[model samples]
Every structure is written in C-alpha cells, then in structure tokens.
Target: MARFLITVVPALGHINPTMPIAEELKRRGHDIAYASGSDMQQYIENQGFRFFTAGFPSFKHYTSYALRKMFEYQGLVSNAFFFKVLIEYNRKLIVDLPPVIQAYKPDVLLVDCITHGGAQLAEVLNLPWATSHPIPGLIPSRDATPFTSWGLPPSQNPAVRACYRIIRLGQGLFYRMFDPAFNSIRASLNLPPLRHCVVTNTLSPYLILIPTCEGFEYARSDWPPQAHLIGPAPWGKVSAQDDECAWIDALPHDRQIIYVTLGTVQVFRSLDFYKTVIAALRDEGYFVVMSIGPVLDKKELEPVPEGFRIEPFVPHAKILPRCAAVIHHGGQGIAQDCIYHGLPSLVVPISQDLYEIATRCVSAGVSLKIPYPRLTPQRLRDALRKVLTDQSIRAATNSLQARFRATNAGATGATLLEQLARTKQPVYRPGSAS
Candidate 1:
C-alpha cells in the first residue's frame, strides 16, 4: 500500500473538508497520516486516520475572544496570526518533520493550499504535492481572467485596476517574505522547491470553483487543466441532538426560514451583529434560526426577541436544505454549503480573504455582500430580502445547484488522488522493502 502524508491547518473549515478525503484514502488501502495541530485530533482520529500533530500556541485562550473579534484587526498580522503561532510555538516543526517524512516516506503529499507548514514540509521532502484549497485563491493563474486575481472582477477603470494593482502588490509582498524561509527548508533536505496543481473547493476551471453556477458568476473564463473544480464538498449529515433548544423547536413553519450564522470563528465577536440581524429578521416576521457558534454565552444574549433562536452550533448541512436562504460570514465552508443547497446568500464578510469571496458571490449574483464593519438592520433587511424575494436570484441559484449536484466533489477528489497514487513513481525505500 502507498503511504501518503496529508497535512492541514487545524481550523474546522479546512480540517472538516479534508476528513472525507482522508477517510476515502484510508479505505483505499493507503496508509494515511494527518499532520496538524491539536484542535482537530479527535475529529481526524474519529475518521480512522492516523494523526500527527505539530503543536501550535494554544488558541484555547483565544476561544473566548474569537467570536468577539470576528471582524477586528483586518491587519496583516491578524490575517496571518495562525501561521505566526504555528511557526513561533512549534519552533521544532521545521526540524521535527523530516523524521516523520523518513518514517512514512509517503509517495505523495496532499496539503491545504493556504497552509504554509504543510507546503514547506512537502517541499523539504521532495514529495509530489497537491493543494486542497477551501477556496479558489491559492493558485496564481490568468486563464480564469477577470476573476483570476484574488477572485476579483477585472476592470479597465483606472481606480479598479489601481486597487487590483495594490492587492497584487500586497500578495506579492506576502509570498516573497516567505520565499526565503521556504527555500531554506527545501535546501536543508536537499529537495527542490514544490510545484503542484491547486485542487480548489469548487467545480470551476480558472483555478477557482464556481460553487454557484454560470448565472451567478459575472466574469467567467476557461480555466487551466491542472486546476480541477470538484464543486462544494459537503460532509455527511449527522442527526441533531435530542436536546435541541426550546426556541428552535417553537419556530413557525408558515413563514419560510432563513438560517443566519456568523460561523464559529466570528459568532462571539459579532454578537451585536447577530443580535441586530435577529432583530431585523424578527421585525420582518420571518422564521430565523441563528447559530451563535461555541464562543458566546447565549444566556448573556438573553431576552433574545421572539421569532428567533440561538444555538452554539447547528448541522448546517442539515439545516441549509430546510432554509429559504442563509446569511453568513462568507466563510468558504458556509458559502459552499449554501451553494450546495442552492440556497441564496447574504454574505456579511468580516475580514481577510472573506471580502474577496463575498465580492465574488455578489458579482456572481447568487449572493449579496454587506461589509461587516458597516452592517446595520436596514442593510441586513435589504440584503436578506433581495436573496429571499428575488426570483432571478432563486432561479440562478437553482441552476447552479443542479450543476453542483452533478459534480460530485467527494468522488471526483477520491478518483484524482487515487490516480495520483497509482501513476506516481515509487520512491526507493533502500533496504526496508526486504
């Protein structure tokens, strides 16, 4: 059996999608070892894959502040904090990885596109690596024109091109800063730098996945052959716990339901924003269920007005199917889930690359983006109403949804990885095979 090393960041959004693939690989008789931090150990092991953790600074301390600061500090530091923590806390990670590389001696490596550690490790080991991006931004390609650069729309207007130029400059600065470090890591192991294809989360060619469909995408292009769009990879649904909240049970069935969540990372930080959305949705007399995620105290959010409900977490995969629309933080995971269900979205993007994804969704017409820092009840109401009542949005989303269904991400990804396993040249194990 071919052994494969799959590495990821421990964030649930990245790790969760990786789970099914890991399971599929193990089931195919490949020895799969996952490398990440402690956060996803249980979930990874639960899927029956061997877990290897490269410890990072305890985000346990930040869990309390996590939800509270959902949109705070859009600075470069905040954007790259997880990576900073991964490097600083796990000083030995660079040094410690080689032995595991030697032990497993994987035939190929699969890494989350945004994860620097995994990418560097693959480079060091000289492994043929493929990137599993939760979104479509990892690969820098031009064939996906217009939407190719950071998924932003291409324009001839001086201001827009200027903005794109600035963004590109920033992106270049960020990548160049690490080029030396990554090159050093590769040199240490006498391995060449990594050059691999980006396997995006969506089923679109231009190195971007169009989770929503053709109608939703404003700027379309023919994508690269190396870039595969596998549609939204929705994980299997698990039944909700018997002890669901009373308010959740009491929601009216007459009005179409709208599921609103800031997702786990921003739920606590955006409590006021969530409350405002609840107030607006209730005022509009719509059935609304809000997942506050785990970082907040629902009790403190007490006197939660009538016609609204709150929970620490909800099975979005289960709930999205039942909802008329979804209002979310525009996380790639949530956006994909919304697209998978063909449900329209009002993307309240907070920070970092979220604005880019949200912008793409808005440009595509399947979703509308309301800037997080500027969110208000009226804007929220207007955006939600547009997503819910706009027939064109619904029709376009439905069409995209059909295409998404036809594009079975799980099977497609499995088939590709399996093919890579078979065709890749076997690495010599010296005397070990005897």
Candidate 2:
C-alpha cells in the first residue's frame, strides 16, 4: 500500500467531495493524511485520517447580494473570481505547504482542482500527484462558452462555436494582464512558466478525477488525457433518527414538500431574495422547508409564511428524500444529489461558475434557470410551479439519474489513483473503463 496526502481548498464544498475517495483508499489498506486549517482537524481525525495544519487567511465575507458593480465587468473580459481564488490559494500554499511535505513525505499527492500551489509543490518535490475536482467545465473550451454572469450551453453548430471563440479572445486579453503576477510566483520556486492561470496552476498532468459523469457535461474531446469524468463522490449516508422521521411525518400529506437551500458559501444573499421566495409560495398549498444557512437570523425575516419552516442549516441527506422538488444556487454537490435522487429543480445562480451550471441544467431539460437580474416573486413562483408539475422534467431527471447510477465513480477513481501511485505514470487509457 502507498502513502497518500490530500490537500483541499479548505471549504466545505471542496473538502466534502474528496472524502469518499480518501476513505476508499484507506479502506484498501493505504495510509491517508489531510492538510488544511486547524478547525477541520477534529472532523478529519473523526474520519480516521491524520491531519496537518495549513492555515489560510479567511476571505472577508460579502455583504452584498451580488458582486460589487465595479467587478461585474470582469465577467465580460475574464473570470475574475476564479482566477483570484487560484492566485490567493497559491500564495498561501507556497509558504504553508512545504513543511507538511517534509513531515509526511507521501508517495502520492491528491489535491483539489482549485488549490493552486499543491500541484506546484508536487512538481518541486518530484512526487506523483492527481487532482480530485468537485466541479467540471471550468477549463475554457471552444465546445462551451466562457463561464460568466452570462454563459451558453455547449454547441456543435459553426455559428455558436464562432461566437464563443470571439468571446474567448476578450477573456484571453484580460488574462494576459496577470502574467507578471503568476510568473513571479512560479519563478520563486523554479517552476515551469505557464500562459493561462487556471489551466497551468490547478490541472494535474497525471490524472484528474471529476466526480460528475460525462453525460452531465458537454462532450469535449480536447481535455488533457489525464482528465476523467467520474460520477459524483457523495458522502456516506446519514442515519435518520426516529424524531427526524416523526418531524417529517408531521408535514401535511395533502401538500407536496419542497426543500430550499442557497448553499453555505455565500452568506451575501440578500433579505430580498428570501422575502421574494416567501411572497411567491405563501399559501400556495405546498410545504416548504428552507435552510437560511449560518449567518442569517430567522427572526430577521419575521412573521414567516404559513406552511414554511426556517432553520440555520439542515443536512441534505435528511431532507432531500422527503422533498418533491429542490431550489438551490447550482453548487456541484447539490446539483449532483438532485440528479442522483431524480428530483426536479429551479436554479437561481448568484456568482462564480454557478451561472454555467444553471445554464447547462436548463439545456439538459432537468431544471429552469433564473439569473439574479431577472429574479422576481412572479418569476420564481411560475418556475417553481412548472418544475413541480412538469412530467417531462421528471422523466428527464429520472433518465439522467439512471446514467449516474450506472457507474461506480468512487471505486473507479480509487483504482486509477492506486495505479498512479504504483506506476508513477498517467492513469487514463483510451478505451479503458473509467
């Protein structure tokens, strides 16, 4: 058995997805250790893995519902937030990660796709490594438009492809402005030069395991040979208590239950957004359970609507099985879970690559998309009703769920990583089972 070290982006969304693969490797008699912030130590040790402290500066949480207007233009010319994340993560890891390597001396390094310096650290140390990615479609592609506030689904038509190419030219021009910044960081460690920040900084040349299935993404032939679209690596099941079942059972049988969560990362979602949801679905004869996340107070949104329940947070595994529909912000975890469970959705994207995911889900006919600019009580109400009663959407979701279930992504990805550590070569092969 080989020793493996896991470095993630230090967020719930990124860390949670990698757990399954790490656990699978451990189950096969491999030693596993994770490097991240101090707060995550207990959680990691509880899962039976060694933990290393590699603290990063916490980002100042956004108070506005969307990006500041001045930064909105970056969406047109470049993916500002994504690149900023890559640069920010790299600067920190360059300082904090080296000692961890000295201590662990792992045979293989598995890192989150957006954790920039981990790949560079592997290169500096001359160790085998792979990327455990939670989201796909971030790589700029001619097959699909650039990820922005406005993005297009993938297309084969010449006109659509040409339009996307033109848009990419603008993004490229903006990306070049950061050449000095990226090169300075690379030069400090004697690393190879790179042109694009996202491509060079994050993607591993050896192997990349994207947990979503190929069917969920636009078909692309141009990905690096190491990249594989493995199905989602969700957490193990959460046992439901008798009290939890009883609480769910108490909901009126006459009304269909709806689960609403905007995710935990962005606390900037305004009071207006929740107010709009309550206004639209109030007394609509449906039971709505909404998770407001950790930051907001339920008392702030006083006089909650009838048949509406509010909480700081609730596990998706507990509430999803009982819901007839889901309304989310298009994060990869919830998106995969919705497809896996065959539930229809209404996706309202606020920032980052979420707009791309929401648009792709719309293209697949499994959900309806509403951008922040177009959000309103009437629009949300209408979209929710359509996703709830639309049989075609249900059929489409179920069909895709079957495709997701057909592959064992966790086991498949585990086998590939094992091959990487053992052979120290590219793990993907043409016509090999993924």
Candidate 3:
C-alpha cells in the first residue's frame, strides 16, 4: 500500500473534493494524511485520515483578509493585493511542508492547484506529485478562451476569435504583476523561473486531475498528455440525526425546492444578494433553501421572508437530490453537485474560476450565468424561472448527470495516484517547458 499526503488551502471548496479520493485510497488499503490549516484538523480527522496542521493562520484570518480587501479595494489594486497575499500564504505552506513530509514519508503528494507552495515543495523534494483541480483546468489552450477571460463561449466567428486573442494578451499583462514575487519564491527554493502563467505553472506535468468530464466542459485539444479528465468526485456530510435535517422535511411539499448558496468564500459578501433573492421569491410559489455559510449570522437577515428557510449549513448530498434547481456562486463543488443530482442551475459568479465554470455551464445548456454586477432581484428571479421551466436545460442536465455518474472519479483518481506511486516517473521536468 502506498502512503499519500494531500495538501490543500484551508477553504472547504478546495478540501472537500479531496475527501472522496482519500477515502477511496484508504479503502484500497493505502494510508492517507492531510496537511492543512488547524481549523480543518477536526474535519480531516473525522474522515479517518491523519491530520497535520500546516502551520498557517486560521481559516478565519484568511477569509477575513480576503473579504475585507475584496470590497475595500478596486481594479488592479485589489487584484494585486489578492495575489500578493496569496503568494505570502503559499510561502508559509512551503516552509511548513518539509517537516510534514519528513514525518509522513508519503509515497506520493496530492497538492491542490491553489497551494503553490505544496506544488513547488513536491518538485523540490523530487517526490511524485499530482496536482488536483477541484475546478476546471486553468491551463491555457488554443482550443478554448483563456480561463481568465471568464471562459467566453467558443465560436468560429473571426471577430469573436480576435477579441479572445486580445483578451489573452491582456491576461498576459495582468500575470506579470506576480512575476517578481512568484519567481522570487521559486528562486528561494532553487527552482527555475516559471515560463507558463502563474495559474498553469502550478500544475504537475505528471498528472493534472480535474473532477469534471468533457460533456460538461468545453472541448480542449491543447491539454497536456498528463492531464486527466475524471468525473466529479463529490464528498459531503449528511447528519444522521433526523432533527438536524427535519427542517428539510418540513418545507412545503407543493412548491419546487430551490437550493441557494454563494459558497463559503463569497458568502461573506452575499447578504445583499441573499436579501434580493428572498424578495424575488417571496411569493413565487417556490421553496428556497439557502445556506448562508457559518461565518454570517442568520439574525443579520432579520424579518426572514415566507416560503424560505435559511441555515448556516446544510448537507448538499442529502438536500440537492430533492431540489428542482440550484442558485449558487458557481463554485466548482456546488456546481458539480448540481450536475450530479441532475438539477439545472442559475449561476451568479463573483470571482476566480467561477466565471469560467459559469460560462461552461451556460455553453453546456444546463445553467444560466448572471454576472454578479448584473445580478438584480428581477434578473435573479428571471434566471431562476428559466432554469426551472426550460426543458432544454433539464435535458442537458440529465445528459451530463449520466456522464458524471458513469465515471467513478474517486476510483479513477486513486488508480492514477497509485500508478504514479508505482512507476515513480516524473512526466514533466519543472521549468523544462512552459
């Protein structure tokens, strides 16, 4: 049995997808250990994996800084500050990983794509590592628009293609902001400067495991040979206590259920959005089940509307199957859950790869994307109505659900990691090719 070490940023979105893979590995008689923030220690240990705190600040600190800066700053300044903080966070993880590796002596390292430090450390140590993308692959390609371009719809129109090219050029300029600090960190680790953009450079050329399938994603021919398209590896908690989920059972059975969440990161800034949703659906004959995330107090949303139920958290695995539709921040985890459960979605993407995923969902015909800036109560209500009544969206969701279910992503990921452990081959030498 091979020993595996999984490292991720502290966020639930990054950590959750790894659970199913880790469980499958353990089931196959492999030992698994997780290195992350201290806040996740209980959650990791609860899954029966050994947990090692990666010596980073609590999740609260990271989220607080992100939330404050995301609202406080604007344009290039906000973007620069976000990357600078992210790089510094990754630096801490890089410093903390050696000791964890020495203690765990893992045969292979599974690093989250966002955790650049872990990815770099894996290379520095010459360990077999596989980069795990909980979201869509960010690798640049000619087959599709750059991920940063909000994943604009692919087309044969020359004008559109030219615009995409211009966007790519602009994206390259934006990436240069991080070049000094990114290269400086690599230099400190005795690694060469990165040739690819920062996002793609973090990928392991040996294996890039994405928890999505071709049916739900844009076709891409330019992906590296090492890239693997495994289906959604979904993992979630379901409370055993009936009382914990009794609220779900009590919802009015006459109305269709709509599951709403802005995801953990965006939830802090979503109060206004939530209020708007509540107002939109106040008498729309739909039952809305909204998860506000634990960071926000439910009391903040005073005078809760009728036909709605709000909670700090709810198990999507248990509730999504019964829902008629999903309205969310286009987070990969929740987006995959919607696909897995065959639910059409209204996606309001705020930041990061969300816009990309939202774009893909729209292209796939299983969702409607409403850019956050354009999201008004009427727009949200209209989008939700379309998702619910559109037969094409339902059919597309059904098609993709079949595809997602056909592939056992957890098993596929486990098998690949095991193979890498056995073969001990490094597919791409770091910095050899951009």
Candidate 4:
C-alpha cells in the first residue's frame, strides 16, 4: 500500500473538503495519516485514518459562533486577520512542523493553499505535495479569471469601476510578492519550481468529476493535462434526532418556507444583519426558518411572530428540499449544498473569496448578491422575493441541479487521487530510512 501524509491548515473549510479524498484513499488499501489540530481527532479518526496532531496557532481557540458573525460583520479581510493568520501559521511551521515531517516521512504531502508553511515544509522534505483550495481563486488562467481573479474590467460607473481597478492592482501585487517566496522555499530544497496544477488545485482538465449537470464553473484556461472540477467532498450526515428543526416542522402547509443560514463559521457575527432579514420576512407571511448560529441569544432577540422560527443549528440538507429558497453567506460548502437542492439563493457576501462565488452565481442567473454591510429589510425582501418569485432564477437553479446530478463527483475525485498516487514517486527523506 502507498503511504500518504495529508497536511491541512486545520481550518474547517479546508480540512472538511479533503476528508472525503483521504477516506477514499484508505478504502483503496493505501495507508493514510492526516495532520491537523487536536480538535479534529474525532472527525479524522471516525473515518478510520491515523491522525497526527499539529499545533497551528491560527486555529487555536476557535469559537464557532464568534467566527461566523465575524464573517457576516467583517468578512475574511477584516482588520489584519489574514496577515495575522499568516504570521501564526509561519511561526508554528518553524517550531512544530519539522518534527512531524521527520516522523511521518510521507511519500507524498497534500496541503491546503492558505496553509503557507505546509507548502514550505513540503519543500524542506523534498516531497511531492498537492494543494487544495476550498473556494475558487489562486489560479491565474484566463478562463478562471472572471470567476477567481480580483482583476476587474472598467465599468459604466466611473467611481465604482475605479475602486474595482484599485482592488485589482492590489490583487496583482499580493500574488506577485508571494510567488517568489514559494519559489525560494522550493529552490532551497532543490525541488522543482511550483507548477500551476500542484500549487493551485487543478488536478485535471475538462471538469471530470464535478457532475456537470448539477453545478457549473466558468470557463478556465491553463488547465493541467489532468485537471478536473471534481464535485464537492463528503459531509457528515446529521441523524434523525439532530434533524429536529421545530420551526420548520411547525410551519403551516400553506405558507412558503424559506431557510436562511450563514453556516457555523460566520452566522453569529452578523446579528444586526440577521435582524434585518428577520424583520423583512416576518410580515411577508412566509415561514422563515433561520439558523442564527451563535450570534444572538434566543431569549434576548425580539419575540418571533407566529410564522417565524429560530434555532442555533438546523439540518440544511433536510430543510433545503422543503424550502422555496435559501439565503446564506457565500461560503463554498453552503453554496454547494444549496445548489445540490436546486434552490434559488440570495447570497450576502462578507469577505474573502466569497465575493467571487456570489458574482459567479449572479452571472449564472441563479442567484442575487447583497453586500453584507448594506443589508436592509428592503434589500433582504427584494433579494428573497426575486429568487422565490422569478421564473428565470428558479429555472436556472433547477437546470444547474440537473447538471450536477449527471456526474459521479465523489467517486471520480477518488479515482484521480488514486491514479496520482500510483504514478508519482514518493520523495525521499534521507533520515526517514528504517
């Protein structure tokens, strides 16, 4: 059996998506050991793989509710959070990562792109590593540009367009500075320079496993010979007991049901934002099933009207099929799930690569996006109304659903991982010899 070491940044976004691939490798008779924080021990071990704990300061003290609201209120770029994350990851790399590398001496290393130090560690050990991105962005190819790049075209609104250009320029500078650092790390270790496919998450070309019928990606160029759009990885299925969302179950059969959740990461931070949504939908006579996450106290918030419902958590997969539409933060996991149900969406993007996903959804004519800070009852009302009432949006979402269903997303991605492991030679670690 091939021995593989998978190192993820420990962020739920990155770690969760890679789990399916790791599990699939195990089923194929490969030996797998994944490295991440201590908290994920249950999740990783439950899948029956060996877990190696790594100390990543950035992920330390994570609060599911606080982080979720932070996204709704500030998004990923709030303050110097990204830079702070970068420093902490680098600090851990210098101290804790080397020993893990020495111990595992893996044949191949799989890392998440945002985990800067893991990439560097791969270089120091001269191991072949593949990077995974939870959201679109990172690759600079032309086809992927409109969807992933921060680069913007001049728009009719001169002021807005100028702001867009400034952001694009900054985007170029950010990558330009980092590319050299990655190359330097590789150079010092005598490994070949980073390639688009290895560093970016393009494992194959032509969207192989993504189940083209359910969802769609914008055209991309500079695809690797093997790069594909593999569909979403696995998710933990909530049990029947956990699926008790009373608000949803109690809704009258005559009222249209709408489910809104920003997810566990950033749902709590946007309390004021959610209040607006709640108020807008209250009088509209719809059955609003909202997952506030941890941001607000159930008792402290204003009393819900007879038709309204609130909960800290809800089974999204179960509720999506019963709802007329969904409203959410534009995180990929939620986006993928919403698409899977073929429900039209109103996406409010706060930060990070979410803006891109929202933009892509709008372009595809399946959803509408409202800036988080600018959210109002009217905006929420209008967005929800559009998605719920517009024939075109509903049609597009259904069409996308059909597209996604046509492919074997999980199985195809597993096949690619297995094939890559078989063909690629394990990088040699000098002191790792038995």
Q: Summarize candidate 4's per-residue lDDT along 1-434 as a digit string, tens digits.
A: 77777776655566667766776777778788888777667656766778887755224355434333334334323422443444445446546667877887776666665665666676566556665656544445433343322223223576765665565455555444444544555565465665432234223121122322223455644444334566665355454445455555556678788888776555335577667877888889898888776446667567777777788767665677788888887777677667778888999876756677777677667888887767889888987888888999888878777766665545665666565566664222123321
What's model 3's overall lDDT? 0.80
What C-alpha RMSD separates each model from the true structure? 6.6, 3.2, 3.2, 6.8
Q: Name the best candidate (by TM-score).
A: 3
The reply for model 3, stretches above 4 Å from the true place, is 55-59, 63-67, 71-79, 149-151, 236-243, 426-434
* Model 4 residue 206 lDDT score: 19
Off by over 4 Å in 4: 43-50, 55-84, 101-105, 146-170, 177-215, 234-254, 294-305, 425-434
- In model 4, the Cα lDDT at residue 312 comes to 74
lDDT of 1 by residue, 173-260 (tens): 6656544544454566575553221112212211222222333333334334544556667776343342353344555768888898
> What does the lDDT read for residue 52 in candidate 3?
89
- Among these predictions, the greatest lDDT belongs to 3
Estimate the lDDT of model 4. 0.62
Minimum summed lDDT over a 10-residue window in model 3 is located at 425-434
- Model 2's alpha-carbon lDDT is 0.77
lDDT of each: 0.62, 0.77, 0.80, 0.62
Candidate 2 per-residue C-alpha lDDT over 1-434 given as tens digits, one digit per residue, 9 for 90 to 100: 89999997656677777877888888999999999866567657766789987746323233232234323442543355556555756788889999998998899999887777888889888889998877677666655556544657777788878888887787677777676677788889998778876655778878988888766777776766688887876664443322344466566778788888877665666466787888888968889988887678889888997899887656666677788999888888888788888899999887776787887788778999888668998999999999988999998899989998887776888899999998998877577544
lDDT tens digits, residue span 233-302, model 3 = 8886443432477677667777899989987667546788888888888889888899997577888787
Candidates sorted on lDDT, descending: 3, 2, 1, 4
**Which stretches of model 2 miss by more than 4 angstroms?**
42-46, 57-74, 140-142, 239-253, 431-434
